[model samples]
Target: MKAQMFDMTRMWGMVTGLVLAIAYFASLYLGFKASEMLPMLVTAIGGFEMFLFSQDVWIKRKRKHG
Candidate 1:
C-alpha cells in the first residue's frame, strides 16, 4: 500500500503537547512562584512533544525522498 500523508501516530504527540501547555499555564494561574521551575518544566515537556510531532513529518519526508 502507498504511504499515507497524515498518520495517526502524531496525534499522541499533539495531545501530549496540548496537555503540557495547559498544565504550564495552570501552574502559573495557581500562584506558583515565577521564580520556581515548575512552569518551565511543563513548558519543556510541551516543547518536546512539539518536536516529536514534527520529527514524524521529517521521517516521512525522508522515506518518501530516499
Candidate 2:
C-alpha cells in the first residue's frame, strides 16, 4: 500500500523524538542545565507523538475487525 500523510507524520515524529531525547541527555552529560523549557517541550511533543501512534493502532484495528 502507498504511504499516507499520517505515516509520514509519524515517521517525522519518531525522528523528532529521538533527536530531542538525545539532545536532552547530551546537555546533561555535558554539564549543562537542561533548562526548564526543554523538558516541557519534550513532554508536549512526546504526548503528541503518542496520540498519533495510538490513533494509528486504533485505525488498523478498526479496519481489521470490520
Candidate 3:
C-alpha cells in the first residue's frame, strides 16, 4: 500500500502491533510451549507494524502542519 494512504487516526497498524506484542509476551510467559517460532514471529511482525505506524503518524503530522 502507498504510505500516504495510511490513517493515523484509525491506528490499525499500532493496534495490530500491540496485539502481536502481547501474543509474543504471552508465548514467552507460557514457557515457550516447546516451540521457539511463535514468539519470534510475533515480535518480528509487531516490530514491523509499529515501525510502519510510526512512519505513517509522522507523515500525517508533517503533511498537516508543515
Highest TM-score among the candidates is held by which one?
2
Instruction: Pull out the clashing pairs in model 3.
Output: none
Model 3, 65: alpha-carbon shift in Å?
A: 2.1
lDDT of 1 by residue, 1-66 (tens): 233424444455567657766766786899765545655766776677668768989999999999
Tens digit of lDDT per residue, candidate 3, span 1-66? 554555652466667657766776787788765356656766776677778679879999999997
TM-score of 3: 0.51
Per-residue lDDT for 42 in model 3? 62
Estimate, for each residue in 1-66, the C-alpha lDDT of model 2 and write its tens digit. 357876887788888878888899999999988878878778888999888779889999999999
Ranking by lDDT: 2, 3, 1
Highest lDDT scorer: 2
User: Cα RMSD (Å) per model?
Assistant: 5.4, 2.5, 4.9
Residue 45's lDDT in candidate 3 = 65
Off by over 4 Å in 3: 1-34
Each model's lDDT: 0.67, 0.85, 0.69
